[model samples]
Target: MKDLSDKALFALVQDHDERAFAVLLERHSGLVYDLVYKRTRDDDDTKDILQDIFISLWNNREKIRIEESIYPYLHRSAKYAVIDLAIKNQRVTAYQSLLAKQDEPFCHPAETGLIASELQQQYEQEVARMPGTMQQIFRLSRDQQLSAREIALQLQISEQTVRNNITLALKKLRLSLGSDQLIVLLPLSLYISSALAVN
Candidate 1:
């Protein structure tokens, strides 16, 4: 494997050769790691994103095309991962700051009906806006009330992946919705966005 070029190794990997994939990991992970770490400045986050990158590679091996070095594709992957993480955190923070303004008296059910309906619409819209994996994690954890372990098992993904998504989902929801989901007392349908804060 050491003697094989990246194109050859990737070809073998596409054919489901685990050793070839391992060799590719050995060869390029450091480059990918440096880019991810530099963007995240957190070892733990870097590790999580890196694990996902490789796992995605293995899962999509049959479809990936490599002409020469694989570094370009890995670099692109790391860049997008960091951006996704940053955006999720940013959007979550913006919503939480609105919590203090929600002290308006609760409306009567009939009067609040339209506002409540709108709130539900926004909540569902935001959930749909989440990146694919995080969306799955949030829906399962929220609508189904599944534990992280259950979600991980059902998704055939790592528990850490479930946990990380949940943590970030909460963090971002706080920014995009509000802490405890008290956005102008809008009656949150996204109550589970705060799940990790207490846990």
Candidate 2:
């Protein structure tokens, strides 16, 4: 129940206790999502990754060795998953680009541009899912390139409130992003870094 620690729950799960597995999932779902989101920055990928993480844990349940904190084990698994995906994506993108150049004298620019734009929109919507006030503050500060004080003045809130909102936004964003991902594109990295500087 509420008194059980993660270690105990994990131990039980290793012993084939289904309730323990449920508790483990409930406890760490956000962490898993955060890691996946940080890695893929795609809703569908995140969902897939989340499912994969749990499936992996279940499949390897008998072999899990949690002598210390269970968090690092989860973190390590999430990180390796991201790295694996990133490598796969790089290979796929490169192959696609090569095939496109070989097949077409002119690249199909519109189709690619539309897909990129849709992904960007999805990323923004994910950001917006944080607390409403934090979302507003983050958008104003990052997208508008406004300072915290300037945001406070425009929104008619205290400067400290602006600062707090930005901080909360970054924390939530970072937690959602998990630990191992860094946006590789300069513009996207700049945008995400500015919005989630604290994380």
Candidates in order, TM-scores: namely 0.52, 0.50
lDDT tens readout by residue for model 1, 1-199: 6899999999998886766777788788788888899989997678768876886786677788877988888888899999999997787687665644568644667767887777677777877888999999878977687776678779999755776686677667667776535344332232222221222
Clashes of 1: 7
What does the lDDT come to for candidate 1? Answer: 0.73
Q: Write the per-residue lDDT of candidate 2 for residues 1-199, one digit (tens) a residue.
A: 6458888988888886756776777778788788779768997666656655775676688898887556777788888888888897898798878887785644378987776676566566668797778888888876777765678779899755775676566556556553233132112222211221221
Question: How many residue pairs clash (N, CA or C atoms closer than 3 angstroms) in each of the candidate models, in the order given?
Answer: 7, 0
Where is model 1 more than 4 Å wrong at Cα?
100-199
Off by over 4 Å in 2: 103-199
- Looking at model 2, residue 199 earns an lDDT score of 11
lDDT of 2 at 123: 61
lDDT of 2 at 3: 59
